[model samples]
Target: MSSITLYSLDGCPFCEKVHDALDDADIAYETEWVEPLHSDRNEVKRVSGQRAVPVLVNENSGVMMAESDKIVQYVEQSLA
Candidate 1:
């Protein structure tokens, strides 16, 4: 099973960038849509310490990070 999990939100440009990067690299990953409020927000905060989009968690490598540019670069370097 793939160990990549992306925490993102719809209509977010940052998240979209990460998505494109993943697709460009043909890396299979699971997505967790972090909604704006309540439960979803809590989940993101719990994992990343901030309620933000474009969070990438690579369990296989023990990498859990937040930031679109970094996430894209990491994905490209690790899988592309």
Candidate 2:
């Protein structure tokens, strides 16, 4: 597994933004597709303490966060 893991849901624009950033940066990461319903996103909640898509977990850096813009910026500044 890659050092980074992105938690995302299908059709989530925010998730797409992060995905694009990672792809553009040529960062090697894994995607964990989350459940469509927030209530069903137990793994996401467990990791990030919330049921939100576009969560990023960087095992190498020990950074676990949520939010697309921040994640993109992080990728640019750190991962990229």
Candidate 3:
């Protein structure tokens, strides 16, 4: 499994979905919590070039992506 860092916001269901998937796969990952404001997503934008919750960055493989379902699938296939 690659080194994973998730940029997420609290109270976001989409982010929670990724969290659940990672936990179920037993993938150890770090979280960088971003504020729920549009401007506060600069960090996410810097990494993924998008302002979206549940961005997953695989530092080892250099796979940076956004979207909850895709992140879940990546965790299952790559990490599992």
| Model 1 segments more than 4 A misplaced | 38-40
Q: What number of clashing residue pairs does each candidate have, in the order they appear?
A: 0, 0, 0
Q: Please, what are the lDDT tens digits per residue for candidate 1 over residues 1-80?
A: 67899998988999999999999999999998878664559887887898978899888889999899889889888879
> For this target, which candidate reaches the highest lDDT against the unseen true structure?
2
The per-model lDDT (C-alpha) reads 0.87, 0.94, 0.89
Evaluated against the true structure, the overall lDDT of model 3 is 0.89
How high is the lDDT of residue 55 in model 1? 93
* Candidate 2 global TM-score: 0.98
By lDDT, is 2 or 3 better? 2
Candidate 1 C-alpha RMSD relative to the actual structure: 1.6
lDDT of 2: 0.94
lDDT of each residue in 1-80, candidate 3, tens digit only: 43789999998999999999999888889999998897878988888888878899998898988889999999888887
Cα lDDT of model 2 by residue, 1-80, tens digit: 79999999999999999999999999999999999999999999999999988899999889998999999999999887
Return the TM-score for each candidate structure: 0.90, 0.98, 0.93
Clashing pairs in 3: none
- Of the two candidates 1 and 3, the one with more favorable TM-score, higher being better, is 3
Where model 2 places Cα greater than 4 Å from the true spot, the runs are: none
